[model samples]
Target: MDKFNRKSIVLLVGLALLLALPPITIAMEEAYFISLFSRIMIYALAAVSLDLILGYAGMASLGHGAFLGVGAYAVGILAFHVTEETAIPFLPGGWAGSINAVISWGSAIVVSSLFALVIGALSLRTSGVYFIMITLAFAQMLFFFFVSLTTYGGEDGINLDQRSQIPGLDLADDASFYYVCLALLLAFVYICYRIVNSRFGMVMRGCKQNETRMRALGYSTYRYKLICFVIAGAGAGLAGALIANQSEFVGPGLMHWTRSGEVMIMVILGGMGTIFGPIFGAVALLLMEEVLAAYTEHWMIILGPVLIFVVLFARRGIYGFLTGDGGRDG
Candidate 1:
């Protein structure tokens, strides 16, 4: 009860701050923070998506970035075709492009979910280290595949002509986009919270604890996990689309295995198995980078030790620490 109260306090305070951040930054003449926090929220979304699988389902995926990249490419390619006034090569007829956020971003979610479906189907067959390695390998495959697309700028990446269009709002405005990202993040977090508390969530946790026991109970753990994996991929895809809008660019680097490692680090730093933990992790890690990088290029030297300390001592991560939770997971 005490822990719940503490967590509630933190959540309330955090939400209030986020809600007021744009105006606060404008008043302080630090409007740049709006953009920075926007990026942070985007990554927080991605981290939360990963937590769905890694935390509750015990599926540690290293190819998660592949979904992110696929989603971004979905947006980028669509915008590119529209801007160039050319039909998409693979599609029949005059399926040119779309600037609609709903269509383009929806494409991102659908395509990424499909990709995750295929990858999860194959990769989930293995367990433990093999699963980790296979994910990493698939991510690498995607990274190189994107790199080879010379038309899309390949290793150099491609630029977005403009932000996705939403009716009654101009996403080109930093503040507007920031709020959109925040809204999506909050919604995704809520959805994850509901999932974690549902019967499906219980089954996921059971599989995480003992797959054999879950199977003996007539649970098709594989199907449940696959569904969970697809849902996570869809969320990550949304994050990727947001990131493309935030940066106004997309590239193969988005799918790199190293990026996956960074996100996993964020999850670990925040608190695995806790839906809200990764958001705190993203904020902490990114802000640490922003502040420390301004001081020196060797910020990693400082960050390395900080992460080591967190992993060594506060194993449950920043959220766990703040909430006074003593358990290892969530």
Candidate 2:
């Protein structure tokens, strides 16, 4: 088959699988499948964002989960204080209005972006282990700060009275919500594809391969890093927003260091730097967790070794074993 035909078939098949998922998981309600897919897509978006920096730009961060937490908390808090009118969230300080859910969703994106910018600016100054720790410190600070906000939920979390309502659709329905999450996943992936191929993306990758070399060529690596960091934060924040809406709840647990580690693991497991890798990672890990937990209570006992083996044996990740990166044009 021609490459175009092959790709189209693949895409069609993927859509078929997703559409079939709700009915296939009859034991679990369609709502459960929808909820699971929402979680998967959100985390996949966050993973893709981290991949931009860690995989493409050669910057490692340990505090990525904080952005997700910030986005979610923003939704939780606003829904609490603002109108119950199912409005889109706004950008911070009422910048944008009525995105999807109208004002509320816009607010979510803005808050996440701003939070990422400030955090990335400070953290980018450091490199290697120092950068990792600094990011972690900042993430932990946010985590604890929210935990201390007794009004919101403190150590616990707050629930959404209602999910973010799509403009004309009832997002409360399982099928509709699943499609929304899937569409966003594809949209975010397309954005990454565009960004990675653009002139700016070329500079970002060049900076990743060699900061000094890129700088010598007259590129400001710091600016590239800052931009990439903001993008990553926005992605994570999007995930947070989805999670809040999916569970109808938001809490500090989503921002913890361990949560950050989970995303990192997803990236690595799916094959760092590959476009499809992070999403694969999220699916494989989550599915594995589901299967193992069903078989036994001590699932972690099996999980730890499986992860170790993958790290040691499948170093290039699942994708590397299936499709050679050098074989494909990026």
Q: Top TM-score: which candidate number?
A: 1
- What is the clash count for each candidate, in the order shown? 0, 20
True-structure RMSD, every candidate: 1.0, 3.7
Say which candidate scores most in lDDT. 1
Can you write out model 1's per-residue Cα lDDT over 29-99, one digit (the tens) per residue?
99999999999999999999999999999999998999989999999999989988899897788899898
TM-score of 2: 0.88
Instruction: Kindly list the per-residue Cα lDDT of model 2 for residues 1-330, writing each as its tens digit.
Output: 454565455446756877677677655544566567767877888888888888878789999999989988877877765533443344355532222464566667788999999999999999999999999999999999999988777998787778877778888876677777777777888898789889988888888777898999998889988998898888888878877887888999988999999999888887777656787788777777777898998887986887787778776566555444422322
Give the Cα-based TM-score of candidate 1 against the true structure. 0.98
TM-score of each: 0.98, 0.88
Q: Worst lDDT window (10 residues) for model 1?
A: 321-330
Error of 2 at 187 (Å): 0.4
